[model samples]
Target: MSGLLHPFIQLGYGLEFKCEALIACALAQASTHRKQFSRALDTETFDEIRAGDLDGGNGLSLLDIMELMRIDPITDKITYDDDPYTEENRALSQTLAIKYAKLWSVGNSESSVREKSIEVMSVIALVYGSLTRPGYRPVLEFGVMHNLTSSYFLPILLDALPLHKKVRLLHAYAFTFIYIFATKGCPPLHIPPELTLADTHRAESAESSSSGNPWMEVIDKAIANNDMHVAKVVRALWRLSLLTAFPTQPNASKGYELPPYINCLYLARITVDSINMSTRRDSVTDKLQLTAQDGRRNWAHGMVAYDEFWAKYGQAL
Candidate 1:
């Protein structure tokens, strides 16, 4: 097999350089400036480049073309999502990935941040579709599934706005694709369990009955895992915690204090999207044991606040 494969690999590479020279010559005419190669290429017909479906084009092997485009699997940082590299298209997967990682780290302001993140994600989706070969349809489909499902959290998670506003944004994004996926019999897709944020109030329910700090314990475990999504969720919760019953400075006034359990549910629902069925069962058991003395009224009020907040900010996004 190696004997046959060695010759095939050599032949494939020969085809690639032959394609590259032709592309370089064709695109060179589009620009007098040699430095404009990437920009000029970016504007060219990319369909055949993407699908390797062109007739009598360059006869370049898909892997060879991708290699010349700097998508060589062994040496290049960017992995192939698709096939042939064309004279008209330039690779931007690595560029966009670097940009996203930076934005995610610095954190954006509420309204502007959401818009920017969506734009970035759109670029990512397009590039993924355009650069891969037709044979990679499943891999591409899986990527789309993962991205769209995971993206459900952005509007809610990043919005510095109130709970209701976030939920409305979430619902809008969710409603766009939720029905289609649900009809296929998928549960409203859950974020990876490690990625979902637990509200401090929810975290505290068991501990409030015991003598310990339930929410803090949860944080400790989350930290030990060192998960980025979990950490981001924790940051959002900390900001929300100021509004909840969690302990803070004594000087903190009304709006900054803890709200109700209902509010926790509303926020959690928005921020995390799909509820874990098991967690819901635990919630029911906890709710059953509650008395008028057990803080349900406060929880109820929080839900109201969430509703009111959502009403005001829902359309902002």
Candidate 2:
């Protein structure tokens, strides 16, 4: 959660929603109170265990890892305290969040500077502007942090959240957490649900209305342009994003069910495999991996803001 938020803040989009992610991380970290994860997971033992788990080369059971790491598990329901929005705080749909983000990444007051900057700037402004007004954080749709902080422990509630919110959570997990865990190596923050397309399709379809697969759209565009390199990146992003949204069970191929956190190494194994495929995959991924890892700590540092910019503007390149 902090990983995703602090980066956006440094990127000059200090919207409250991004702040919410950090706050959520702190609150959840402190939820146990007896032994704060903030203090415990920092020790060398935990880091060694994290690395050792990867070296073992086996199934990464999040439940077993959580027991070892002593990270509290969320197994219930939780929501934001404030619903003072213009409308409601009903989990900002992922589609809506992306849509709003896309909308924000555009012209503002009719006299903005630079052409390309407008798109990204508009998104920052939309979220930031909506946030300054007191009752719009929930309306704008950036619950990646909320879910990260809360959802890991309470995956049962994933369906309750709006489609956009679910998408935001998946985006954060794959783009931020999983990426960091795989390359830079870090403790797994939260475990995404290990459900499958079959596991979640019914509910997600009902909630999202199947507005044509977003992943397919990306793939289609790449094929149309004859850009295999772009296709590789897009495919990697799609794989991670999809995992966040509909993670397969531990033995998904063999058939299993899980809503548990696994080993960081095992998680990383799956994630890196997901991201680094296709002949076109190459060193360009280093930059993306760095962004995911660095964006967490470092405050006004560790920034990784250009993913959306690149994804949206891939055609220009």
Candidate 3:
């Protein structure tokens, strides 16, 4: 989860393409970043929780755990001014994140793994789409965007692991999600109203005559764009759309329940459109490179002020 998710992402790519060298490089990268959170992540308490020994042995769903983090007073008090990466702050945040995250049980069955993976993917996508401030230029926050992209690797990583390791990975991933939400000023999450299948069809049909299929348009733009983030996000969202095409009732037993409004296709469209609009107004390449040089300044690592975010790239109403 550290290194702004680079190691995790690299490992995903390695698993995805079956590249041993990339996998090795990712492990090497991960080794370097583990010490900072080792105290928080490597404790017996967390291990017990991960093993389903706590919370009645049937932990909360991932979304439920997220809600807990959102409403927790302590998390709400954490702000960008607090400098969350400092050793003291990082330890505190990680402990809190792990506390909430442990309440989400990683079920033992393969079916449970699939369900949890989809749930994680859906929740992150919902967050990415929902974080945009109303009346703004619709630019997705760079920091929040990584959560969505990094989650793309979950299914890939889980598929190759055994049941025990799968549980461990899921626990760590859930913890990372909570930690990010807390550190990013605990931004309010306002998920849009549910988009029924009919609603999505009508919306797509309305745009198809002139645009020739909204999904294709998004895919085309993503492929043509030089931005890796653009391509990765589009691809991930497209996969999510397929995985979540058939809406299901919220079943607490499965530990995965998506809200009615979280249509992956709709979210994907919004993401690409926002990225396009944002890039047109600024040098995304330059900004990405400059931020990459300093991880803290990188849009994915820092806290962006809401007002500054609204006016980023000199964008006007």
Candidate 4:
């Protein structure tokens, strides 16, 4: 649950490949994360709250929960320091994250587990792909992007765990997602209708050939690029695109609707476009020159100012 999800991701790969060594490494990594997270996980304080919350049946979906948090006065109270590792900042943020995250329930049944996992995957994609400042060039925020990439492993990890462990893992994952979102200043989400409708529009067009599929170009660039993050994000979004295609109906019983903005294929295209804008091919080597600093420089970090984000675009809205 810590280390920006690297430990869990490693464990996912280990399980997928049936490799003992990688699993061992993941366990070792988990042992080194901040003690506060471990303590929070061990505490039973939320058990009663969770039970009472679940008694009313299904709670709000992750997307709805995020919206509540976004507008809540508490969101304004979450402040970040230049050094994110400051103990005071982390303590305050994690406390709030757990408080709000408990609002969502990971059900005990197998079908519930599967449904909850998909719900999470969709919401994270919405956050990662849609939370951009209008009129400015798209910049995938560094921290928020991890929530999407880390989610790619949820299905893999959940499949191997027992029902109880699966529920616990989802809780931890939710906590992490909320904490990161708060730290990123709870940026306002805006789903561009054009981006979400890209797939539908393409299918109806005359030029709907294999060569015309935008994903083909996105994939080519992703594979050609040397950055591992680009490849991971592309693969994750592609997997999500496939998963989202068939589940057209919102789960009324579970109280979750597939938000209109979640078109994973187009989200993948947006990510690739953003990366292309931030990088240039070296003339001599004919390869992209992407450095850690270059990646950080082009992305928005910390809180997003509401006034600035809406300054130029508010009139149309």
Please provide TM-scores, in order, for all candidate models, with all chains considered together. Answer: 0.21, 0.22, 0.77, 0.80
- What are the runs in model 3 whose C-alpha is more than 4 Å off? 1-4, 51-56, 82-89, 194-213, 246-250, 254-257, 276-317
Candidate 2 weakest ten by summed lDDT = 295-304
lDDT of 2 by residue, 1-317 (tens): 34333332222211323555664555554453443123213345333323322243223222232233222221011112222111121122221222222111111211211221211212222221121122211111123222222222222222334644433332232222222211111122222233111222221232565465443444555454332323433332333333333333222212212232222222222222222212233486543231222111111111112233223322221
Q: Taking the tens digit of each residue's C-alpha lDDT, what string does model 4 give over 198-311?
A: 355232123556755767788887776555667678877876776666645246464565566467677776766556324557899999875443242243454453554335
Displacement of the residue 158 alpha carbon in candidate 3, Å:
1.0
Q: State the lDDT of candidate 1 residue by residue for 155-214, as single tens digits.
A: 334344464344333322322222212111111112222222334444444325634644
Model-by-model lDDT, in order? 0.29, 0.26, 0.64, 0.67
- Runs with alpha carbons beyond 4 Å of true place in candidate 1: 1-100, 103-108, 131-141, 160-317
Model 4, poorest ten-residue lDDT window?
A: 308-317
Q: How do the residues 65-87 of candidate 3 rate in per-residue lDDT, one tens digit apiece?
A: 76777677776455544244665
Off by over 4 Å in 2: 3-37, 48-80, 83-317
Give the Å shift of residue 121 in candidate 3. 1.0
Candidate 3 at 278: error in angstroms? 11
